[model samples]
Target: MMQSQHPPSNYQNNQQNLDDFDEVWVPNPLGQTQGPAATSGLIDIIKSGSLDSLLTNPWLVSIFVATIISVLIGAIATILAGQRSTELTPEQEAQQALLQKSQNLEQTDNNFREYLTRDDNNSGMVSNPGLLQAATLEAGARYRNRIIASLNNPQNPAYNQHEELINYNSEIEALKRINLGASGKEAQLKYVDPSTGLWVTIPIDSAELAASGLTKLNIISNSRRETTQRFDLVTVAQNIRKILSEVKAARLEALRVKGLSPVASELEKTDWFGNKASPSEAEISDYQQYKPEPIPANPNTSKQTQDKPSPKPTGGQDDK
Candidate 1:
């Protein structure tokens, strides 16, 4: 194999390469090795069409710069995307879970409200505030159960943690129950009957009801008799009715004593707890329509008027 005796001038710069030969390696696109051109050649490229032309052409320059910027931005975006994908730390995950749980709880609360609305729709008119409250509570229990069932189902949006939906603060839940008219732990509630102008007291056990979380609760009806917590609301209402009946009977007796015509035969009579506290429509109509007899003048007053007569015609002296 024959090797060159001296560096080929086309392949080397002997003058510049006085010391290191390592600096003269060149890059070629044709798959062949070459020598570095004179640095002057780069000046020519800058001054003429090679690099100068691209720099001079505004559109080409813009495209090139924009392409470089776009590539840089894309690379940065990819890195950011990767970082974001891995950014879910334990604390972040917990916060996200808590937010989702709160949303689920709020949704459950709305459902509970809807259930209360349904309870109000029932044919039974809960006339008394106590009755309305009790109904809300009964319906809240049913709503909670339904929420549990939905959460357990795979198709449910609140799936995987049904109980969390109902795990609200004790006081908050109690307030909701009361707002919805569920008798959640309230005691000594008073309601006034429209017919009778008297307030009826409702009783419940405070400590027991407060602890029951409004989900399940019972309280004494008697404020004084805390030991006897088993009185029924219906019974209380009945007693109120009886009291009202007595008041109506008293009113009827007054009318009877005044010699006023009775509105109804029943209106003139007292029937204790068995009777209604208010007059019937027919009785009310009769009372409005009937005319009472006028009171007779006192006989003694008329006799005195007669006895004091017989004054002589002395008008001038009387006037003086």
Candidate 2:
């Protein structure tokens, strides 16, 4: 090969001989020498409108920065989404279900509390036996049909965990069986005729009923108070309140199993149990002091007891 005797001026600055060169040398922006392949790639970038605008145009620089930032943000968001979409373990699922059941029980208890504490007479006590009985039946139905039934449902993870609910169910059922007349319509009176061994229902405002002594009949019909094992609204309410405490404790335990704490709003509410004792003297007075209103006199009514002929049991046969 024929070699050049004189080197180029650029090679002279670097003190290099032309005979040592394998290819022409080119300087990049970073002051580094590049091969033909690198030079070609740089030209491609320039032709693509990247190198010049990215380095000189402020708008282009801003757009480039924004693109890089958006890419990083999207990557981070994908990672977070993967974590959030992770499924709960079987144990976690059980704990979550139990917690939900207990919370529902607690809410029912709160509703019962509101109904039990209602005082229509405004005398600081619920001095209306009729209203009181209605409240008790309502609370019992809620606990049995709604609360206990839900807890004992086969689909519930915590099913069969609360056996006490079954006992309550029995107690309410017994009360319902014994106190049939108490839940009758306010406009009617219900009584079982001993002579005919049948139930007789009569309108409260009927002159025939007034003649039959409706007030006395009501007292005799609602004689469940004399039973040895009778249901009391105040007592039931107090028991339900205690049940709320147990439910809260159970929920707290479920949270602990899941390695979580009760939220700030519930910390205080679940921290302590509430009154579990018998209803107060005031509460007892609510029912004990009840006075039945006197029925108006019917002049045509007979002083003698009129035995109603029984055909079949009537009145609120529904019982509930």
How well is each residue in 123-242 modelled by candidate 2, as lDDT tens digits?
A: 223344333444443444444444456576899754766645554454555444334434442245555433333344555543433333433332232322222113555565555555
Using lDDT as the measure, the top candidate is: 2
Question: What is the lDDT of every predicted structure here?
Answer: 0.46, 0.48
What is the TM-score of candidate 1?
0.22
lDDT of 1 by residue, 61-141 (tens): 777799999999999999999999989998787666656655555565454444333332233433433433453444444
Deviation from native of the Cα of residue 239 in model 1, angstroms = 32
In model 2, where do residues sit more than 4 Å from their true spots? 1-70, 73-75, 78-82, 121-320
Clashes in model 1: which pairs? 133-181, 133-182, 133-183, 205-219, 205-220
Q: Which ten residues in a row have the lowest lDDT in candidate 1?
A: 220-229
Q: What is the TM-score of each predicted model, taking all chains together?
A: 0.22, 0.24
